[model samples]
Target: MNRSARRDGTPDRGRGNPARSASDKRATDKRATDKRATGKKDAPGAGRSGGAPKKPHRGQANTAAVATNKRGKPKQAKPQRQQVEANPTISNAKPARHQYVQSAGPVKLAAGEGMRLQKVLAQAGVASRRAAEELIEQGRVEVDGHIVVEQGLRVDPENAVVRVDGVRVVVKKDLVHIALNKPRGWQSTMSDDLGRPCIGDIVSERVSAGQRLFHVGRLDADTEGLILLTNDGDLAHRLMHPSFEVPKTYLATVNGVVERGLGKTLKAGVELEDGPAKVDAFTLLDVNGKQSLVKVVLHEGRKHIVRRLLEAVGHPVKRLVRTDIGPVALGDGRPGTLRVIGPGEVGALYKAVGL
Candidate 1:
């Protein structure tokens, strides 16, 4: 046998083509090394598919380690993770905190606590809810002295000072507004210093303690009719102010017949002792042989204005009873009777003075 031949009759690796021998030895060594490291054989046809086993990437693998099943099919390996025990005494999360801030504008009432502003105005007889909203939109309504335009704004009506058209509205529960039918001889004064019959005697038993009221306008000792008495000073002042021009109505019995042209003359404005005055309206209701029952409407508050106006027309008044003031009327109420003004009437009065 040749000295370099193997016992199987194959050329000895050390005796084959030198370069080819080296390459075959390296290939054999690589396969043996890979088998030792992986403890597994190459997949069938793996060498023909890619020609070589690729080295691991520079970084750790992102994929899970793979394994083979009983059928030699690859399956994902269960991930291995370090186990950690929880410590009840320590936590990394932070707790939450709550805070609140108040505003400088009108105080905001909590939910379901106070009444709506427009409703308050409506209840206080300022206007209907719809009209009150319109007033607020026009920048004419105020609450707690600030012009509030927001609808449904909550308010404490008893505490809030509301105004419309610059006229203060009385909303407090303790404040009283009364309409008294004065007797013919009852003085308009709150209290008669001379011990004569006056308004105080009539209202003293009707009102609560400490509720002192003042008359809006005075009537003569002989005149009788509807007179407003209230603790609302602002309303009284506005009603009495000449610029407001709140019309008053009177039923007067005068001597001699009222001429047809008398109403025209009275409305044309008759010159009075203090100033020129005019009747807003006039109507002759009934005619007797020598006396006439006439209705006169005027905005003047001059002393005995109704009597003076009638006398100026050549028919002197014998008895004059005011039937209405602004939106209020006596409505056949007996003498010395007192009635709390209704909300509608009060609202009408507020509108009359531009409130």
Candidate 2:
């Protein structure tokens, strides 16, 4: 083998050239310096090393004592994270709180000092006492610009400002009385749930707007006659009371011929399902042997009183119509017609009811 050839059959250039030998030595030294400067151990399988790198100790990873500066000095302990003390005066440390307070109770009233709100409203013809209470509860009734929801609240009727739904309520002193010649098949109520024709249909248009008119007494759907309509609840109530004895007169056409003494029998008393019903007067108007027209007067306002009384006497009434209630007569007003009750009739009604 030649001197330039190695035993492994490779060229021995580094041994043959001094300059190449010096260059290889300097390259190795530079790599060693670089590794030491980076403070990292030589990698495995790198720079003639052929083993896996050693792992760092478990606890030494997080310890500040294991960490060092470039000069091999331990890093100054991260200025020890200072503890903060909370200042109570600072709003961020403790949030501001709100204090709550309770509301005041209702005001008390003296005895008879002010009229009850419901009574005033009812007397003003707004509604019944129960309905007025509902209005107050619904926050619809207000007095002097304040909404009143409490029951039994009273205010001066004449002096205090009362309103319903922002409309000032004025208590009407001048009472209105209307007499209607109600037609058959017309309900006595202002409204009917079954959509039947009601007396209000004929009388409501004639009366002033916002006037709440109620029938003084109810009449059956079949009966057509003089029925009183008024907003005067007190007068109506008194007229309807049993103690007042406001008489009602009716003309009934019966199926049988009434003999003489039948009037006396009816005047005496007729035993009814409710109680013994008595008529003030009963008169036979006309008898044609086939059917008879009879006039009956009674103070009781029982339902179907005239029909029931005649039926109990074996004479079933074929047609019944009320002609008079107290002194208010049906006059010449036709069926489904209404007329204003004159002052004379109104006075007589009030006198009859003792109102």
lDDT of each: 0.82, 0.81
Q: Where is model 2 more than 4 Å wrong at Cα?
A: 1-174, 206-208
Q: Global CA lDDT of candidate 1, please? A: 0.82
- Predicted model with the maximum TM-score: 1
Candidate 1 clashing pairs? none
lDDT of 2 by residue, 182-245 (tens): 8988898888899899987776664557777888889999999999888788789999999999
What would the per-residue lDDT of candidate 1 be over residues 97-116, giving only the tens digit for each residue? 75444436577697698888
Question: How many pairs of residues collide in each model?
Answer: 0, 0
Model 2 steric clash pairs: none
The weakest ten consecutive residues by lDDT in model 2 span 99-108
Candidate achieving the largest lDDT: 1
